[model samples]
Target: MTETPLAPPSARRSRSRGRSQSPRSNEPGQNLHLRVPYITRNIPTYDLLSEEALDRIEATAERILAEIGIEVRDDPEAVRLYREAGASVSDVSANAWRVKFEPGMVREILKTAPAEFTQCARNSANNVVIGGKASVFAPSYGSPFIMDIDGTRRYGTIADFENLVKLGQSSPWLHHSGGTICEPTDVPVNKRHLDMVYAHMRYSDRGFLGSITAPERAADSIEMCRILFGSGFVDNNCVIMGNFNTTSPLVLDGVTTQGIRTYAEAGQASIHLPFLLGGAVSPLTMAGSVAQCLAESMSSCALTQLVRPGAPTVLAGFLSSMSLRTGSPTFGTPEPALGSLVMGQLARRLQLPLRCAGNFSTSKMPDGQAMQQSMMSMMSAIQGGANYILHSAGFLDGLLSMSYEKFVMDTDMCGALHAYMKGMEVDEDALGFDALAQFGPGEHLFSTDHTLRHYETAYWDSALNDDQPWETWSEQGGIDAAQRANTRWKKILAEYEAPHMDEGIDEALKDYIARKKASMPDAWY
Candidate 1:
């Protein structure tokens, strides 16, 4: 068998160009670094529940949908669509309707959604495929406050948002440029989405998410994509995605349902997620919460198909376990991680791409607690076979804050995951029979030819970890991982160069933003 590198073939062909000292330690910027467009899992998904158990959970979801029903608030169009699609609809109030589906109605309606599709990036090489055995890593989303390098927590500005986008673009491990890396509190509430979308367009060429706070903002995001990518291309292909959340305990609010329809009608992709907090918005029991999540997400995703058949949609689950005594939210716990695993199984059963758990933590700082918690949550996403993994880095304070130091630290972990998910290949080179023949019982293989040929690319090298002896560590100020991550992020930002864009396209995009912003006066609320 031929000897091959562990990374995807696409990764081996790429190289770091004009990069400063890499944030990763040990490896220089000029080294033979591997970069995958997205993770194609070679290993099998870990199925924790039996088929019978999964069937039971799915049945429970159907029961919830048929009996209890989901209320559509302030969206008559959504209510009418549900009614046309064979669901029972009744008036809950003048502005709300109770829409209930038969046991199999939702499953049939979801048949039009594609299982997998490509989200194109400005640079074609960075295009990522969602669904099947592929997985994409992206940064944390929707953080209003940031934990600064000096440990001060404050509101995020547009500068901070741009910097985060730059950091994501610079990392070889992250596939998609995430949405709402943090809220630009300094910008007006009505107009900040334009700036956020522009930052993703100018600073990064990777596929990214769009705004979903309102339907018009969602339309604005799609319009900007048309300027960057041609109109025909935008209409026919998926260039951008919107991440929308459902109000939990069986409710699809107007803003979210309308947002889903907006992206679907435009032929773009959307992730329908139910952010369920156990004991609060959902059932206290894990199984009950999982069933509720499936019901809520499935109904919301079906709306996308209703708007336009064969539109791309991703099923997402954000399950959190809350403290029973104080009713506070918890993250990176084992229960929710288990919930994520189960959700993966359910998504596969439905033949849809899944977005699951991430590097979640409640720790205020980038300490041992943070890493430990992140590993527990992130591993579930990896082992469970999720397609798009959001919050892949920099999540802290129960997701109330995005830590700058934690962001780089989490990227380093993502680098390791790139290797971990590659699994292993067994071949002629891997057998190493020639080395065994040359070495005696008491001899070592250190100087063998096989060792020399493969040593450089043998293992995943970490950049932030210090493995030196105590004396060397002490001489170097005994810096910890967080301190090292702090230095690295600053270094990365200082050297970051925005990917080049065409002059004409840039001007058109700026003109669009200017006209849009000028139309609306600054509304800070």
Candidate 2:
């Protein structure tokens, strides 16, 4: 990439640019910053996994599949495919089918899979390729409100799809445009998943997160990505799908697992997310809750590895506590914060990527509480060294809704946290011995030529935080973080521009969705 020229010292001095003048009375101090590593130390590292344990887990999973078999149901096409692959099947009912697994088949599937994947952004420089030393971030799962052009908020709709793609295009931090933005209610139910895939490809020049309604639909989604980026591109550390709901021992479903197998066979990385509600689904104690989550996630990971040995998979454990009184999932609770730290440690032990939730808010609007919770949670995940952090933005009330203000706040917070994780740089220029000499002790560095030369290199937090005094804050209407976030949201939306796409690619995506819709069975619109 070409580098931009730096501004001259004199020019920088005249600009009067530095940290925001707003008083940071509410800013957490140095002690708060120290908490990053403190929480990180609580979890165990990846080195804990013994070679023998990994082997045992893999072997045990294969035996479980071969001996016990997986229950497949409500999808005849999936049943037929498994049977054709040499699995035993029983037609339990007109709509249900069960498949008996063979250990060898699982191994065969794993061999062809890729170990890493990459999600290319519109700007190639910002691209996030997963499966190696680095980690990537995705927008939070399942948000309901979508930001519109008029600066108004409404329920997520097809239009929100366009806006989200545009936003993803603008954000270098977000690696992929995820599914489940706004349900394309106007589209047929079976075809809605396909429509989302098509929209992501055409509207944003980034890799996609796959989650179609069924196995066959997942195949179509993979194929679309393949056609856009080329065959095996989807397998090359680009595509990822969450195998959720199916991995829960208490609520194992057929359709989600079918999607997992389909993606696994296609060589895409399949991350098994075992979501447990601490007070409800599992034990209330943090350790016991985490252990339960570990068992569930590890079981799924073991199964995926057995189904496809050495297949690129992640251990995803989402343990949120449920509010016993309100019957709501409370993401802002302290238990989830602790759980993510532990889960990150477990992933490290397994020598696999760990996917955890972050930037989650329970408040209906972006507020002080929202900012505090989101930042704290995200810092925990990053400090714990999670490989892929999901649900990084636009979520609230435990993923049931999204707020535009909160999304923008998250963007700013993510930017700052990412800066924090970069730690300190130690180049000769950064040492600033010459600059130190230029501005001796007892002298102000602000007016020195050396300070002027390098001032822009310093990190500056965005508007979500202000460093003004109470007097200044009160004069400015005493606006809290949420009001400021809303202002930022409006500003970003005002400057929003659509990304450039390949000529005719948009038309082709629409045509493909139309053809798929036309081909679906009458029962499925």
Error of 1 at 521 (Å): 1.0
lDDT of 2 by residue, 1-525 (tens): 012113222222323534321112113331123221111122323333356744554555455556655555565555665576677877667766555557556445434334344444323433454543555666666555554223555566666666665555455445556666555445556777776776676555444577646778888877776655545434544444644554443333567767766776766666777677777776777666665565555544544554455556777777777778888877766677777776766655555667776887677556667767777677667766676777777776567666666766676666565556556768887787777688688876787676787665465445467689999999989987777776765655566654444445456666777798788663434
Instruction: Pick out the ten consecutive residues of candidate 2 with the lowest summed lDDT.
Output: 31-40
lDDT of 1 by residue, 96-181 (tens): 99999999999999998888888877766677899998999999999999896685899999999999999998888888899999
Q: How close is every model to the real structure, measured as TM-score?
A: 0.95, 0.75
Off by over 4 Å in 1: 1-26, 29-33
Which ranges in model 2 have alpha carbons more than 4 Å from their true place? Answer: 1-116, 120-124, 145-154, 232-243, 306-310, 427-433, 469-478, 521-525
Q: Report the lDDT of model 1 for residue 237.
A: 78
| TM-score (C-alpha, index-matched) for candidate 1 | 0.95
